[model samples]
Target: MLIAQLTDTHIRRPGSLAYGVVDTAIFLEAAVAHLLALDPRPDAVIVTGDLTDFDDPQEHARFRQITAALPMPVFPIPGNHDSSAGLLAAFPEIAGRCAGGRVNYVVEDLPLRIVMLDSTVHGRPHGTLGAEGLDFLDRALGAAPGTPALVCAHHPPFLTGIRHMDVQNLFDAAALEAVLRRHPQVLAYTCGHVHRAVTTTFAGLAATIAPAPAHSVSLALDPAAPPTFHMEPPSLSLHRFAEGRLVTHRSFIGAFPGPFPFFGPDGRAIAG
Candidate 1:
């Protein structure tokens, strides 16, 4: 089975730009179109978070229109910029089943279960998982038993060592870790808040952050250095499961100008 993960859309209203520069909507469309063009397409698409820039009703409406043409199922959750109530109102189908509450949900995709955790605290740039959220995870993971599952959230539960982004990580991660310890079936923890491709381990399980499709975050390894941003090409991750192993591939949307060569059998090119 194949799973396509799209993160950090940060979509804005039509004709609106993000941070007065980047055109988020256009890039998002390009990213989606690229995914649809993939051969043996993914079974479903899981959008980690930051679905909108302003959480406006119109933004949500426009987002639906743009994604409405996707051939596979698209699952989304709220980020710091989203409004749980507004999202529910915009899509009654998701709202009806989610019960219009916290926006956290779970789906058993068979052979691979997905637990979508809501770590977005109202009006806050950082992330936090309350006591209730932890309890829900425990129960959901326990119910699934031995099925290999993936835990997804809008925020990274572990530190990425980046200066500005580290401060905004999930605050109550220890509590979340305790729950993860009890559920060993979890294969990996996936998130998208930092706007970078980060890989770390939490509770002995792999944790990966998907790259943003709109723009890239500045690399700030130095604590004293100022934060910066990048306007590089957008990218996403594809998770494929074959023969009891899960492999991940990072793909950039546009064709990069530079290139090398294609290898052939016997480590030599068969033709020019």
Candidate 2:
């Protein structure tokens, strides 16, 4: 099963731009086109979060229109920039009414039982998977003990070491970790928030923060350098499930000069 992960899109209305700089909507459109052109289409797409820059109704409407072009089903959860009401209203199909105000859900239709966690701390910059959120996950995992599960959220549970972003990461990963430990069936945790393609471990399980297809966060690790972003090729993550394990690949978005065959006309290696 190939599941494409797109996160931190930060899309805005038709004319608006994210951070007063990025034309996020255009990037999102490019991302959609890129996905549709893939040879082996992904079975599904999980949009980790920050779908909108301001969580505005208009932004959500535009987001829906852009994503509607996608051929595969989309599963979206909330991020710090999003609110439960807005998300639920935006994608009523995916964000179906749940008990709590947060948009937590479980999808068992696919090969992997995906546990969509809500890490958004409404109206705040930081994120957290509180006790109730963890409990919601526990119940979902407990319901299906043997199924391989993938935890999808917006915030990376572990500190990213990027001083600026770490401060706003999921503050209490310990609580979430406790729940994950009990469910050994969970394969990994996939998220986005730092706007970079990152790989790490949390609660003894693999974790991936997919790169944004809109813009990329600077990789500068300088303690004094201010937070910034680069036009560095935006990208997404593709998780392939096989042999009871998951392997992730970073798929950079945008066109480039490539695909020159390795073998020449005579079946000889191209002499550089």
Return the top candidate by TM-score: 2
- Give lDDT tens digits, candidate 2, residues 1-272: 89999998898877777778999989999999989988799999999999998899998888889999998989999888888789998887765546677888987789888889888888998888888888899999999999999999999888777889988989878888999999999999999999999998888899999999978889978877799999888789999998889999999888989888999999999898
Total clashes, candidate 2? Answer: 0
Question: How would you encode candidate 1's per-residue C-alpha lDDT over 126-182 as one tens digit per residue?
Answer: 888688788888988989787888889898888787878889889989999999999
Q: Candidate 2 at 234: error in angstroms?
A: 1.2
Maximum-lDDT candidate = 2
lDDT of model number 1: 0.83
What's each prediction's TM-score? 0.93, 0.96
Model 2 misplacement above 4 A:
265-267
